[model samples]
Target chain A: MIILHHLNNSRSQRILWMLEELELPYEIKRYERDSKTMLAPPSLRQVHPLGKSPIISDGEVTMAESGAIIEYLGQKYGDGRLIPETGSADYRQYIYWMHYAEGSLMPPLLLRLVFEAIKSKPLPFFIKPVARKIADETTRQFIAPQIKTHFDYVEKFLGEHEWMAGHKLTGADIQMSFPLEASVARGVADSYPNITAYVKRFQERPAYQRALQAGGDYDYA
Target chain B: MIILHHLNNSRSQRILWMLEELELPYEIKRYERDSKTMLAPPSLRQVHPLGKSPIISDGEVTMAESGAIIEYLGQKYGDGRLIPETGSADYRQYIYWMHYAEGSLMPPLLLRLVFEAIKSKPLPFFIKPVARKIADETTRQFIAPQIKTHFDYVEKFLGEHEWMAGHKLTGADIQMSFPLEASVARGVADSYPNITAYVKRFQERPAYQRALQAGGDYDYA
Candidate 1:
């Protein structure tokens, strides 16, 4: 049996959407992040030592990391359905976007997040001003443009075809949709109209709606 | 035929080693990072816009990202030699280690680099002493122990087992060896004897030497 340990308003929304896309019946084990601190609670460590989200168990094997989980599921349960078989051009493109989503696309956005939170401290400590400068400079000077550019790149790629990978919906779309949506949620998506339109199409999918029902209140807040 | 677009003293070292481990004949097109800035030169952007190293072109397909390239090579040429066949426990473990090398293990160390670079910069006018306090406090309080703790995890894991993927030297070893040697080169390995021993074992391999020769100065710095 496949089991998904999900966290609401977090990356697990992608996993849920993936499960729906695969039409794979699975069990959901939900956890909530600390509201005031916006941190994952210590109780999550009991699920896995890493104390992170979107962990899955298949048979007896359990693992953390969202990218790994998405890759594993595509390999294990939905090989024919969600993943492309190896060696074909389609398969190559599938694998490329799979890695691209986490590898090339995410670092700057995440660094931007950490860069911002460290600056949110009300009192200007010895470290506060520097943190604020890095975040402020980064968001305006580097990160915002980069995120918009990557989103535009994705939009142009999508224009050439339908889905992120190809004509069919593959796991790459499933994996990428969450982060793309989260960017919109954080208001960064407003600058990329192409991404906004693409995301709207993503929302219209019944599978996406089903995932939201299972996963709970998720939106650009 | 395999073609590697490489640069000296970069991640290309690992890719070259991988080709050697597979005993595949390949051509290297090399680039040098800017001596002044120590960043990959803009010339690399001609190959891929990311301006990163360790890209491989096998026939018509070109791939970037070290983790992706390693997996691609393992799947293509080193199937029996490096990675396990698809749908096996060995294959599953191989995937885990591949992701772990670049994702979980490398991030924290890289984060330290970012923090240090922040400190290395001249403190802005009026905030100099505070920045020093933050940098000093961070180095003593967090970075040192966090690094030690991470390496210790590797040391203990390696101490009990012959290799990272347990009993055998699979592609996981090749994937992780760069970072392990890197930790050593960066002065993080001295504290972990078993990790040092493991690095020695890796260095003793003839194939590793060929890869190092191909990579020029990189060969684990």
Candidate 2:
């Protein structure tokens, strides 16, 4: 059986959802964040060196990185589901989103989170305003605009195609779900109707709902 | 013809390297970053919506994201080169590094660049110290440590395997070349002999050298 070394409130939740979508029999080995630091527990490193969440082990194969895991499982067990036929335009889009989710999209969103934390985290009163200013300026000047550009690009794409890879739901959408969900949850994507509806449409899936149950305490959902 | 919408000092340089590795005929349409802002030229959006570097157009297909472009070329043109066979452990490693390069690795490195910029950028005299403090603390506390963790992880991995995907040099190494090069060029990996050697090993490749000539002004190389 495959074991997802799951971590709370991380990308692993989406992996769980993917497994559910494949209807694969799997087990979840839950790991929680350090409540204070919000970092993945050190024990998680045993699975993969960097200790990032969503590491999965099946027999001798242990993998980290959501895109790799998704592609691995899709190839191994998907049986023509959740994957576009290779060489099609949809396949190209699938590969693009698979990389773009973490490569392009998540970085800015992660920066937004880091900067927001900088704004709110308690600091010496003298330094507080300066820190807030720095965070605000960085967000306003750098992070926010980039995020808007990406969200706008995605919103327009979703408007044209029902799914990230096209009309049919593919692993690209599964790969894309977390970042878009986080966008919706953070209120940054409130104006993006297509994105919000995309999130809602996926969340309403019985498989997604089941994955939520199997996983626990996901704030983004 | 595969026309790489090349951008100076950006990820597209690796796409050029991949093209050379495959010995494919390709054209480079160069875009330079803004001298002051250091962002990709606005005109790149003509090729892809995100306007990010490394967009490529071959006939009807126009694609963005380095991993996608590399995979597309490897599958369509590689003809049993760079990519590993399906279901093999080497293939798994290839996928991991493909995603890990941009997905797992680049974000913190990017944050380091942003914070480093924050430290050095001209600011109001009164606010300079506090801004520096914020940048320093963030780097010391978050960005630097994360980068270290990753570099160390990679160093250990490289110690065990000659290439990212095992004994053979694969597309994973090409996918990984830029950030590792950036790490070395920035002097962070001066102490990481394996990484430095890894970068050096690939840089000396005839294809990589050819790529440098074709794609001008790549700082990381």
Candidate 3:
């Protein structure tokens, strides 16, 4: 039996969504983030050394990294539905979006989160303004611009195709779901209708709704 | 003909290495990073909207993201040499490493670089120490520990397997090359002999040498 090591409100939600979409039988071993730290609890380290979510164990095989898990499920259980045919143009785009979601898109979004957290941390009266200035300047000069570029690129792509890869729903969409959801939560998605619309379409799917029921509260959507 | 849109000392070097390993004929259109901004030149934006290095074009297909590019090359040109056989445990491990390299590993390394840059930038005498404190605290509290965890995890994996995916030098190693190289350049690889040794093994390969000769100056080695 396949067992997903899921964490609340984390990237693990996408795995649950993919599992639902594939109609696979899997058990979720739910983990909660620490209330104060907002980090995956230390107990999760028992499942995967990285203590990361969306990890799954099928018999003896234990895997981490959402893209890898998504690809694995698509290959082993997908019956050729989640991925495009090998050597096709859609296959290339499929590969690009799957990797791009985490490799390119998530990094800046993560940095933005970190900067915001840093900005909010209580500081001495004298140091507060300096800290805020650094955070704001970094956002303006570095973080925000990169996020905008990525969103712009995605918007342009979605404008052309209904889905990330091409005309069909594939693992690319599942892999991309979390980052885009987080973007919507950040309010950046308001300016990019294509992205917001894509997220809305995803939310409207019955399988996605089922995943939401299986997985716990995810406020990003 | 396959064209690699390479930038000096960037992730694109891995594509050249993979091309050499596969013995595929490919041309390079090299772009230089801006000296001051340290960002990819605008010329590359024409090739891919993200303007990131390691974008490759074969005929009409233009692709970005190193993991995706590595997989494409492995699938289309590998002749079953660089990637493990499908449905095998090694193949699963192969996919995990390919995605983990960029998805899990590179982000912290990139943030460390950015933080270091922020720490070094000229600032007003009064604000200099405050900026340094924030950078230092972030590194100590957040960045360095995560990096150590990643390095420890990699060291353990290399201790068990000669290559990233079992015993063979698959594209997993190619995908992982840049981050490990950056680790060495950061002076962090010394404590992790397995990582340093793995990198040494990689650097000693004739294909890697050929890639260096063709791709020009790479200081990480």
Docking outcome class, model 2: high
Pairs clashing in candidate 3? none
Per-residue lDDT tens digits for candidate 2, residues A1-221, read 99999999999998999999999999999998989999998998888888889999999888899999999999999999999998888899999999999998999999988899889989999989888888899899999999999999999988888888867788999999999998899898999999999999999998999999999899998
Q: Candidate 2, residue B189: CA error in Å? A: 0.3
Candidate 2 chain B has its poorest 10 consecutive residues by lDDT at B212-221
Q: Per-residue CA lDDT of candidate 2, range B3-101, in tens? A: 999888888888999999999998889888899998888898877778998888899888888999999999899898999998898999999999999
User: Per lDDT, what order, best first?
Assistant: 2, 3, 1
lDDT of 1 by residue, B46-143 (tens): 88766778888888888887877877787777657777777676666677777667666776666566567656766566665655555455556645
Error (Å) of candidate 3 at residue B34 is 1.5
| Each prediction's TM-score versus the true structure | 0.90, 0.98, 0.98
Q: After superposing candidate 2, which stretches have Cα over 4 Å from the reference? A: none
A178 Cα displacement, candidate 3 (Å): 0.9
